[model samples]
Target: MRRPTIKDVAADCGVSKATVSLVLRDSPQVGQVTKQRVRESMARLGYVYNRRAADMRSQRSQTLGLVVTHLRNPYFAELTMAIEDAATKSGYTLFQGFSRDEVPQQRRLLETMAEHRIDGLILLPAHDSRPEDLLETVGAGQLAHVLITRSVRGYECDYVGADNVRSGVLLGEHLGALEVSTVAFLGGAEGSSARRDRIEGLGSGLRRSGVTSPLALSLPAIGDEGGIPLVDRMLERIPCPDAIVAYNDMYAFGIMNGLRARGIVPGRDVAVASFDDVPDAAFQQPPLTSAAGHPEIVGAQATRLLLDRFEDPDRVPSTVLIEPELIPRSSTTSWSGRA
Candidate 1:
């Protein structure tokens, strides 16, 4: 029996061969409805796209690689999905790797992707990553690359990330307005640039609001489980802080749980705010107040930057910093400072 081809799919969908080709490539030129119809036809006819043959003819793999710090973090998960969506629209397949914020693991992932010959790469640098780690593959231009979420020290590379300092300032100002005398920052890795920037901005905002000093603590781990023990330690301090700012929503959620275990109410007794207003932030027990990092924007922009790099390899590298918005919620409201 003869094998199904693009022509057979085109004829079945009542579209031109060119149109069928466009659909196969997932071109933006094709309307969604038409793409859906063409896909249906292809499925019904068992038409398979010969991507390898296409790559051979184009001398390109039409694939992009993405390496994220932590997929368990909701923010990175959403960011990855957004990048995939953008890549698919541009006729590129996206390959993903999670480094778990380990420099060695991240380096391994980059080499593996280069071995696979992906056309481009987008990376969220792991904690404590140095420029040398990326200079070999990404800096040497073996593959087009864009850095997202975090940038490596001394690496002059294209980057897209949230304006973390501004996000921290916003959160700090919000907490200050509540007339809280003391603030404690919890969670996140100590080596993370984003964490440092957030702390700086938080302290600046707190000082501007007449709050003298802010306490900061970096957890060995950053998720909810790690956050549970943090509350007790903070409470042990002289005149326990009146509010808490978490590195991310997960920390805030865990801290809230810890607070409840000790019969401390979140909003009324001690306000809680966090960064990365992930999907679950709103539905938490007291609806967390958080900075909307907009991971989708970061992901989409990172993909766009990488695509542009492919078009003009010699163009000057660029950096994009998306400003964050504060989402006020029940968790940070109705605060009555400690007695």
Candidate 2:
């Protein structure tokens, strides 16, 4: 069977080969009418563009590398899929890797992806990652990259992520309206930018509502522990918090589990809330209250920033923060002592 080529498409569309090539490249010079005609002709001729041949001629890979922290996290998982979707639509193949919040692992992944000659990279930096850690791969001009969801100190790049500070403020205000006093925060590793921003915002919101600042505990490592052990530590404080705000839904789930283990119902005994309103948040036993980060939006925006950066390498770095909205559910609203 003979494969249809650009020549056949051009012939069918009554356009020059150059015009067909322009349409294939999605150049702005091609008008919509001409593009439509070319596409229709392509469909009729079963013409498929040879992206690999085009890449070779252009000296480009047409490939992108994406490294995210904690792929198992539902929010991150959703964000990754969204990024891939956006990249595929833009005619770029995405290679994905999970860093698991480790600096060494993340550095290795970045180096490995760079070796493939990717056109660009999108990263969610690992906990405590320093700018120097990426010097050899990204900082050395080997590849252009965008930061997503997390930022590293001294590393400036296009970034797209949730407004963690706003997320915490929204959560705090909601809890304050419910008359929840003496709140505590659990989960997230110490020194994470997201955690620091969220904690700052929570404190601001609490103080604005005449509530005292929250007691924050940064876990050294996040795992299945789910803040089970922190329950006792919080209880032992001078005044036990009536409510807890977790770093994210997963942490909230763990705290809820721990509370249940102590014969304490999340909504009935102590209010619980968290960030990132993943799908499962609404289906929990008590239905968790959460601030929705909208990872899909973050992912899409990050891809846009990276694509734009590729188009204009000399442009200044950009940062986009998608605002979060708090979703109140039984977890916080059903606080037994709410007055």
Candidate 3:
């Protein structure tokens, strides 16, 4: 069977190929009557408009690319969903890829998006990716790229994320109000802006409440695996911390599992608090107390920012910092603090 071509639609609509092309592209220049006629002809002839071919001819792809460090992480999942929703509303489709925290994979995905001529990209860079070329290529190609959940220093680009430092500070204050002396900090990885800001904020909050030189710990970047070992080591210490502040809810969950294995009940033996109030946090045995990172707002705002750049390439880069809110649940109910 022969495939129907644009010329067939043109002939059936009694219009030129150019008119049919414009109508297929949904160009506003085509009158409503003409667009309706061309569409009706296409439907009648079973002629499908080739978007890829049209994009190749026009040198403009209408697709958006989204790359994240870990899709398994609920926070990233929420963000991706929001971005997809906004892209659909704006007549654009999204192509998503995950790096699994691998820098090489991230670079490969970036190249793929570029090769496909994706209109824009939203990236949550890998924890170890510090390449200057990454930003250079984005700037040189004039691609609209927005950083979500993470930001690179000295890069002039649009970014949307929570105030990690403030979140940490709030957590520290909460612990201090509970008079939780000898607190410990378990974090994602060193050299990550998110980790640095969170630790700094937590330290400041603890200091302001008269806790000096609180024992801070940095776990290996092996996600959940690192959390168990770190907690085991902490248990061996003579004077264990009465309260544990984790980098995120995943780490907190790991800690809870480790404690359970040691016959220690979390929220009772030792209070635990973490950030990023992912859905699973609420369903945990004792329900994790955490800082709400608002992934949906971050995702929606980042998508909007990138689209704005697409509309006006000359627009100035912007930064959006969302405030984190503390959710107190059973995890810290036993502690001496306001419920």
Which structure among the candidates has the greatest TM-score? 2
Task: Give the alpha carbon lDDT tens digit for every residue of 24-119 in model 1.
Answer: 667787899999999999889888778785665378788999999777789989999999998887778999998878889988999999999898
Alpha-carbon RMSD, each predicted model: 8.6, 7.7, 9.7
For model 1, the run of ten residues with the poorest summed lDDT: 216-225
- The TM-score of candidate 3 is 0.80
Relative to the true structure, candidate 1 reaches a TM of: 0.81
- Please write out the lDDT profile of model 2 over residues 1-339, one tens digit for every residue: 899887688778897665676687887767899999999999998988798867753776878999988766899999999999988766678999988888899989998998888989999998789888888678796588999888887888788889999998888888878777678888788778999888888878877777865554434334445567767556665444688888888888878888888788898888999999999999998999999999999998888788766545788888899989889999989898897
lDDT of 2: 0.83
TM-score of each: 0.81, 0.83, 0.80
Reference-based lDDT, residue 199, model 3? 82
lDDT of 2 at 133: 87
Poorest 10 consecutive residues by lDDT, candidate 2: 215-224
CA displacement after TM-score superposition, residue 34 of candidate 3 (Å): 22
The positional error of residue 155 in candidate 2, measured at the CA in angstroms, is 1.3
